[model samples]
Target: EAGVVQSPRYKIIEKKQPVAFWCNPISGHNTLYWYRQNLGQGPELLIRYENEEAVDDSQLPKDRFSAERLKGVDSTLKIQPAELGDSAVYLCASSKRTGGQEKLFFGSGTQLSVL
Candidate 1:
């Protein structure tokens, strides 16, 4: 099968602009995740979805960021009124199931630039 797919591989916006990213995970994968990575840092889990339900989102900035996995398949992540500090790479990953040792497949990621 195919790996995860992300659209608009790159985005550039001014501060306070709204931006969105899309992801399509591999078929049969029951768990999906959204992560953000700043320069020189590892990807940080922003949200995790098991099927269509969001299972973990503690690291997500609810005030300006939101995500949704519809029908346990495709997902979208949005950031409204993005700040200059929000410039980073947004990554989408998925796995067959959720577990401590399960391997994850990651998309190339959407690189965001806020000026």
Candidate 2:
């Protein structure tokens, strides 16, 4: 089976510019997650979705970052007027509850550089 596929593995933009990342998760996965990883820190959850509903997004920057899961399959994350601090790796993951446990699959991630 194929794993998640992410587009434009890397991106470079000037400060105050806009950027977007896309992810297509594994088939049949019911839960999706978006995370951000800085240079020296572990990935932090930006958002989580169950189907088309956003179940958790407290960590997402509502002022500039927005995300959506379409039909519970494809997802996109966008940042407008991105700042230099926004440079990092954006990760997309998916999981399904099985036998009382959730197993997650992750994509390679999109690396962003805000100049």
Candidate 3:
């Protein structure tokens, strides 16, 4: 399946500039994440941190995008020298195991428009 479709909401910014998106996950959750949704595609994991340690960040563009989770509660995703193709929605999610299953909670997302 293609997953849920996304809308075109965005935060406009010029090219070759720096922009940052912040997220605060639900309380008591141990996993925090940063994802990027490009147009109609599903959200792609940019970075996943398990209690302040980056466990998965291979999909992230280290040359341009950087992320950090402070105390494993709040997270910031920054992109320097934003490109036009960077226009998309940035999603933040948190997950925790409950009843032998992973429960994920997502944020509304910050959509970016690189001009």
Whose lDDT is greatest here? 1
TM-score of 2: 0.94
Candidate 3 regions exceeding 4 Å error are 1-10, 97-101
What order do you get sorting by TM-score, best first?
1, 2, 3
Off by over 4 Å in 2: 98-101
What tens-digit string does per-residue lDDT give for candidate 1 at 56-112?
999999999999987889999999989999999999999999978999999999999
Q: List the residue pairs that clash in candidate 3.
A: none
Q: Looking at model 3, report the run of 10 residues with the lowest lDDT sum.
A: 1-10
Q: Considering only N, C-alpha and C atoms within 3 Å, which residue pairs clash in candidate 2? A: none
For candidate 2, write residues 32-56 as lDDT tens digits. Answer: 8899999989999999888888988
Given candidate 2, what's the lDDT at residue 43?
A: 93
Candidate 1 residue-wise lDDT at 24: 97
lDDT of each: 0.96, 0.91, 0.81
Best by TM-score: 1
Tell me, what's the RMSD of every candidate?
0.6, 1.8, 5.5
Q: What's the candidate order when arranged by decreasing lDDT? A: 1, 2, 3
The window of 10 residues in a row where model 2 has the poorest summed lDDT is 95-104
- lDDT tens string, model 3, 1-115? 1221223245789999999887877777788878888999999989888889898899999999999887877788899989999998899888763333686778888889988
lDDT of 1: 0.96
